[model samples]
Target: MTPIEILNKIVQAESNAREIYSEAESLREGFDNYVNKEIEEIRKQYYERADKMIAEAKERETARAEAAIQELDKKLEAELDAAKKHFEREKDAVVLKIFKLAVDADA
Candidate 1:
């Protein structure tokens, strides 16, 4: 081939290579976009799961705390009842002793 003809062929080959490279780049960009969208969806799902788990855990903790408070209230009520009974007994004993002393002095 003539030198000019060979140069023309080289230019044509280079142009075809550029077109192929551009098409490949476009396909790669599209795939990357698809992958990013899928990743975002997965991340959103993970967050939703985490939120649900956290809410369940909070409910469990609240139930446990309520049970503990109820138990403590029952114990406190029992202790108060015992204290009241003891105080009444002591008051009656002291009153009887004072009455006896007053009557014996009069005698």
Candidate 2:
């Protein structure tokens, strides 16, 4: 072959190699972008799930607190009723005893 033809063939081969390298670089960039997007989506989903769990936990705690308050109120009301009954049973006896004491003192 002629020197010019050989040199032209070499130049063509180098050009093809450069094109292939460029295409490979572009494909790698695209793949990297795809992976980054998937990672971001996964992170977003995880945060959303965590937030929902926290809200549910808060609701459960609030319900427990309300129930405890109601039970305590019931106990307080029962004690008050018992005190009223005791007072009613004792009030007449206490008044009669005082009256007897007054009469004895006067005599």
Candidate 3:
């Protein structure tokens, strides 16, 4: 080949290599963007599920505590009623005993 033709072929080959490199770099950037967006969406879904579970647990605990309080109130009311009935049955005897003690002290 002539010297001038040989030089032209070398320049053409270098230009083709540069174009291939640019195309490969652009494709790599596009793939990276796609992966990052997918990761963000998955993270968002995971947090939402966790929040739902926490709210459900709180509701169940509140209901259990309220039920325990109601049972305690019922027991307190029954004890108070029994005490009232016992006092009513013994009040007259207690009053007569005090009156007899007062008369003996005066003598």
Candidate 4:
């Protein structure tokens, strides 16, 4: 690519990240207030990594930026999976507790 095109691409990437960041901020706010504490923390980590990548890209195409992004994605997915399992366990416990209460009441 030409020098100008490369610069343009970098600028576009930054702009795109900025736009997504605004949306991500909203999501983080909602997550903080509402639900999924685990995911909310993961999302915050993701944005931080992404911001770093954007800054790194400004210097040059680092060999590690893409790998860093992929790592972030994998980490986020794993955290979400763990959160889901935790929620499922909690739900089951709630149900079992309610059932036990009912049985005790009947007895």
Candidate 5:
């Protein structure tokens, strides 16, 4: 071949290589974009599940706290009722003691 023909062939080969490289780069970019989108979707699903779990846990904790409060209230009410009955039983004795004290002071 002549000098010009050899140089032309070399230029054409380089041009084909550049085109192939560009096409490969574009395909890689598209694949990366698709993978990124899939990752984002998976992350979003995970966050939603986590949020639901957290809310359920909070509800359970609140129910337990309310039960504890109710139990404590029942205990306090029982204590108060017992005190009232005891006071009632002592009322007459307390009044008699006061009466004796007043009579002795007068004497």
Candidate 6:
């Protein structure tokens, strides 16, 4: 081939290689974007699940505390009732003794 024709062929080959390289780079960028989007979606779902689990645990703890408080209140009420009954019986006995002493002194 003549010198000018060889140079033309080389230029054409270089152009073709440049086009192929550009196309491959574009495809790689698109794939990377798609993978990043998928990862973000998965992360959002994980955070949502974690929040729901925490709320459920808090509700269960509150219920347990309420049950314990109710049990304590019942026990305290029973003790107070017994104490009041004993105090009333003692007061009546003392009043009766004072009345008997007054009656004997008058006689």
lDDT of each: 0.98, 0.97, 0.91, 0.91, 0.99, 0.92
Candidate 4 residue 54 C-alpha distance from true site, Å: 57
Q: Write down the TM-score of every candidate.
A: 0.75, 0.70, 0.69, 0.31, 0.80, 0.68
Model 6 lDDT on a 0 to 1 scale = 0.92
Better of 1 and 3 by lDDT: 1
Q: Could you give the C-alpha RMSD of every candidate to the true structure, in order shown? A: 4.8, 4.6, 3.7, 31.8, 2.7, 5.9
Clashing pairs in 6: none
**Ten-residue stretch with the least lDDT total in model 6:** 86-95
Order of candidates by TM-score, top first?
Answer: 5, 1, 2, 3, 6, 4
Residues 1-107, model 3: lDDT tens digits: 99999999999988989999999899999989999999999999999999999999999999999999999999989999888898799878878889889989999
* lDDT (10s digit) by residue, model 5, range 1-107: 99999999999999999999999999999999999999999999999999999999999999999999999999999999999999899989989999999999999
Model 2 lDDT, residue 97, Cα: 95
Per-residue lDDT of model 6, residues 1-107, tens digit only: 99999999999999999999999999989999989999999999999999999999999999999999999999989999888888797978878888999998899
**Model 2 steric clash pairs:** none
Provide the lowest-lDDT 10-residue window in model 4.
58-67
Per-residue lDDT of candidate 2, residues 32-79 (tens digit): 999999999999999999999999999999999999999999999999
TM-score: model 3 vs. ground truth: 0.69
In candidate 3, how many clashes are counted?
Answer: 0
- TM-score of structure candidate 6: 0.68
Model 2 error, position 96 (Å): 11
Top candidate, metric TM-score = 5
Estimate candidate 2's alpha-carbon lDDT, on a 0 to 1 scale. Answer: 0.97
Clashes of 6: 0
